[model samples]
Target: MNESKFFWQACRLLWMSGILLVLISWGSDVPVSTAVSNISYATTITVDSSRDVSTSLSERCDTHTPCTLRRAIVQARLLAPAARPVLIQFDIPTSDVGYDASQELWELEVKSTTDPAVFRTVEGGQVTIDGTTQPHGRVDGPKIILVGPATGNKNGLIIGVNASGSHDNNIVRGLGFQNFKDHLTINSSHNTIEDNWFGLTSEGQQPYLRNDNPQDGSGSAGVVLISGAEQNLVQQNTFLAFDGVAIALRGNDNTVRHNQIGTNALGLLTLKQTSPSLLCTPEDWLGGGGISADGTGHLIEENIIAGLRQQIFAISTQPDAIWVQSTCTSCTIQNNQVGVDAEGHEVGVCGRGFYLTNTKQVQVIDNVLAETYHSALFLNGALYDANTLRGNIIRKSTPWLIPDDSPKGDDAILRFTGLPDPLEFFNPAKITHIEGTTVSGTAGDGSPCPNCVIELFLDDNDNINEALESVAVVTAKADGTWSATLPTPLADGFGLRTSSTTAQFNTIANISAGTTVGLSELYMPGYVGYLPLITR
Candidate 1:
């Protein structure tokens, strides 16, 4: 009985050993299938006549199937290699699949391979990349080219090129992207989007409907919805009739140069709100103000901004033209021409030139302002203490109306009323030399206030009271005239005194109960000085 039991135990152990061997062999063979699935051969599946065909990449290379354009893309992607670039060309236009304005014709999905950056997808579609359709997965590579008639149905292109890394050296060129409710989002950095046309014609409703929740329209944008991207460039593109904005930039250290942005509800709004949690707030919405910038260390130069309806208007009741809310510590806005209104009427308009708010250490120089309705440069609700405005030519800004006064073109310079006490009565009209260095002439309406006190204090320290002893107070005679000889040397170093100043003459008599006040001339040297009077 003991011998029989031992023999049965030995047989049981042998059966267990054979099962372990089978499991090991199966594990080793499974990788072979995985490797085969990842590697694909070069194959072309054409659809000359209309038919839907389903075939694997291996079978496609052996037998060319006549398939629809959408299915052919799936087959091509399935058989692509990790390192090699694949070129899929749709030569024929077939209507057998039916016209789907929602979905694009060839929707290819490039899955997350072993190394996505090494693989590229090149598509030349005869039809459009409609908004309702979903394209393939994220493709990683140095280059992604989509050429042909590609329209954003109401939605735009979802190019998820950068998942990791600081830079995405991707190139998207030669495609027509239009009518997208939302922006064609480019999440990657260091990319180039060039030679594209984006705009909208619909006025009744919003431009695009969102995918997750279809109730709201995506809000039209020209090209590239920039979020968290830096050091990227958008150039040489034409934008028209978008509801929200042409191009909105959220990231910093980026450059938007040499682009023609015009005739939309708004144009090129830039926001610098970097908080990820607060990205979708209403403050980020683009109404107008071509190319708004909120972040720091950004350069907005050399772009033509024309026909901007309200180039600078607030989303809420707040007023500003180019609203710079973020702390852009050191930025430069130079060599740009703003406010040549093609429509020729400026009402409810902001930033005819610029509206700066809560920003410091900015330099605005060498810009031309032509035919603007508001102030050529408006600084409101903020301190422009350390900022510099030099060499800017502001011409033809007339009929300045700011919800308060109806000042004509003669009241050209506009400044905030009620400043500090020492500079309190500082009129912008007094400082601005409109007729070039002659303050003794008649005012805008030819009526001269001859007794108007014009004080001009010089830079040098000179005692006019001690110099002219007997005639200390030099009072002007009639005919609105006053003249004073220099008690000290009238050379470069000496300046005029404030106390012993003279008054000018008056032409119109002040009618106080039908009585006339005598005319007098008041002259203060520093108050009526010309261009070379003050030195920086």
Candidate 2:
């Protein structure tokens, strides 16, 4: 009996051991699936100075090592390549903690050596980098996104994404890039920058970099540098107090529309390079203007540019504004309004309505210039043939002198050759006379004279001869007065000749040198017929 009981106990122990081994195997396999699932996964990276870095908020935070935000970004880029839509949230104190106006939070260097196909999505972070990071170098990249905080103190987030032949197909949305030094240079193709607040202060330095040195003066510009980028879209941005241009574009086949660019030294400036020698100068640079396109086959339309000291200066600023040097061809500046001030004086100095220089095959149409200090359209240098200026409303105002030249008011329409006066042929005061005249005869008394015969003659060949066929008849009234309403003839030549007579007069009196007698009816004798004159 004892041996049988012992056998039962041994069997029970073996079963229990088998169950424990099964649990151990299951635990070992579960970890492998968990590690594999994390590959190419979407993750959130949050940066806060107060939180302990070692805390395992997620699987990403494994250690407590102190790392810079810029380093964290580099790691994220290396770790995740296929996983899309990664968000980086920045929780920095506005007034006290990590908010250092003197120092930069992040600086991204884009150069030609960088890969153009790597796509990165960056959001909700601040970056500060000066020219010293890599002085005199260009930053290039493709597809970088920058996002800002939703609700916090208005500390003015600053970020610089300067690229040269790099940033193609990238998007920058929802941030206040204030006091950014140097130009937010972009020389890439197919990039979009929209929905950001940009503030400017001076004419030569960026606003964000201006705080670095009190003496190293640079202009505050919203978006200054652009060259050789194609099909870029810059829309829905606010540029305030910028000394340089709000948006300076120098690429082909780009669209800049629907942006509120104001309160700058100069609004928008565009450039194109013929030989690449006639680009903008250091002194000619102003802080205001909105969206100037200086490359061939580009479009600048439907943008609100106001309160600028200088509105739109499209001169040969180094690279040029449309066509480089003298080869700007096939560009269009249409449907834009300038010179409407939101505040300040009714008239502002250092302002230009729209300046065009050395361009061809361009069209400027459907623009309204109201209360400006200079001419609505200033065409300088050599404007080529086949260019058009139509449907523009220029409001009338007193002349304001810009340096040596006095620009006509908003309503002034000017077309000049060389340095001659533009108003010689386009005189606004000249009255245009219509087609025929009226004649009345008086009776021996001072009463009305009816039944008067009147002769009509063509003044010049410039008049519409075809129009005379429909309404070219006149009859004397009861008071010896007659009136005629001339009709224009149609191209088909099927219309009536006159009301009074079917006979057409081929020749009439020559009134230029007064009246002369003994003149034959100037006609091709047998070609057409006319009524013989019956003298009263």
Candidate 3:
């Protein structure tokens, strides 16, 4: 063929590929320019009153008139199909309607269960409800609060109207949610919940004092992503002192990062109770922990979870800091500070750091856990296989087997079931010598690991891998011996550790005991205290 004819054919193929990509984006409900129109005018709505009144169909949102939050939501939902990506901002003054003078706060109570305080995105439309525009808000937190009803299981803000709707690409930010069964529930995908405070006052210094007279016994949750909700981001929020889990994540492919669970806003203090009368009853079923996750491809990272336990409740069992259910797979938990405060102080949790059962291909890496009353890592039985635990630091974890085990703190860090030879399955990399960046190690003990991958790290004196710098990676010989030369000379006064990954199942093991450069060493166990990696 001629050169001009060939170039014309190539251009045709490129145009066809672009059409196919647009179709795929629409099938996944992605907001491309073709799928969703950018309505610049008449897309911004403002709420000047804190009243919880419904709006009529004829009276849509007008920027000049006074509107309530519920009215703003109704107006946004009633927009034409062409108008989308609406922004609902607040401009309520101190003397606005529904503002309490004695309490000095603006509270929007849910008026009805049928039309609750919710943000339901229309199909192919997106919405953002921002409370940062409130005049009385603090510099760091929100000033407007959403309160639930007195006697029912009401949610503060729901992303989808129902399970049947594909309400996607909505955002709720810079708000305070309290006194609801669930502060927020997302039944849609591609939503973002950031910079919000759950179970706390707008100032983020105290819990919201509820006015429930009889004290509704329904448990509370910070944020809940229901099943089939995928690709959502829950970040930079404070979840404190709820009766149930801080984040009940039942979605797939979601990312929950940089949120404070079971702690104060700054993570410098432990969480306090939301109300003195709100207690967990014997029949409550959802009080799991900081994060109760049950789906695949989830990432829970960089959160501080501590002080989550009920002191006066009929069900006295405390919750795990992070619980991955049996059905989950390919989830990653990394860079989280569990069972401790942000300052590395021992603000202990009543349960284990991680409670994993029958999970497959889960990675728990580079987490620092301290002062857990139960074992730091708990695998229920032999059915839990093909999971990886690499570069974790645990201190002051106790053995908790039964209901009343008499609380021996910091005694054990691991509890795995039915491992006859624990070392064969859980062998840490052993560094025998390190001379001028060439580090040598025994990567295996027996048949559990062969031709393993040894990963070396340079942590700054602390045992934990804080900077996530992997200095070197080398493969072990079939005989279980390995050696790797780094790119640069090993620095003085810096600590080093190695983590081993087995060749057969690709399972990553815990990091070896740290070794200081140029220092002679006795044999150091992988775990610092009483227990080994697993117990029979």
Scored by lDDT, the top model is 3
RMSD of each: 25.5, 25.5, 11.9
Which residue ranges in model 3 land beyond 4 Å of their true spot?
Answer: 1-42, 53-66, 100-105, 112-124, 162-165, 209-219, 270-288, 311-316, 397-415, 418-448, 454-475, 483-500, 506-536
**Candidate closest to the true structure, highest TM-score:** 3
Task: Quote the RMSD, in angstroms, for model 2.
Answer: 25.5
lDDT of 2 by residue, 1-536 (tens): 12222332332243223211111121112111111122232644453332223312222322334433343344344343344334344443434233323332322222111222111222222211111121111121111112112211112211223334322443444334533432344545655555444653223122322343322222244564355667666654556434445666676777665455553312332211112132122332233444555667777665556545332334412111112223446776665555433222223223556666555567665665554444455555533333445444444334323334433322233333432222112111100123223222222122222332223222112211111111232434554345444344222212211111101111111111110111111111122332332111
Instruction: Report clashes for each candidate as comma-separated counts.
Output: 24, 61, 0
- Model 1 over residues 152-231: C-alpha lDDT tens digits? 33344433434243225334443344334543556666555654444422221122222322222233555543455666
User: Alpha-carbon error at 493 in model 3, in Å?
Assistant: 16
Rate residue 384 of model 1 by lDDT: 32
> Cα lDDT for residue 374, model 1?
52
- Report the lDDT tens digits of candidate 3 across residue range 6-39: 3323322432232211212212232232112333
Error of model 3, residue 399, in angstroms: 8.0
Better of 2 and 3 by lDDT: 3
lDDT of each: 0.36, 0.36, 0.60
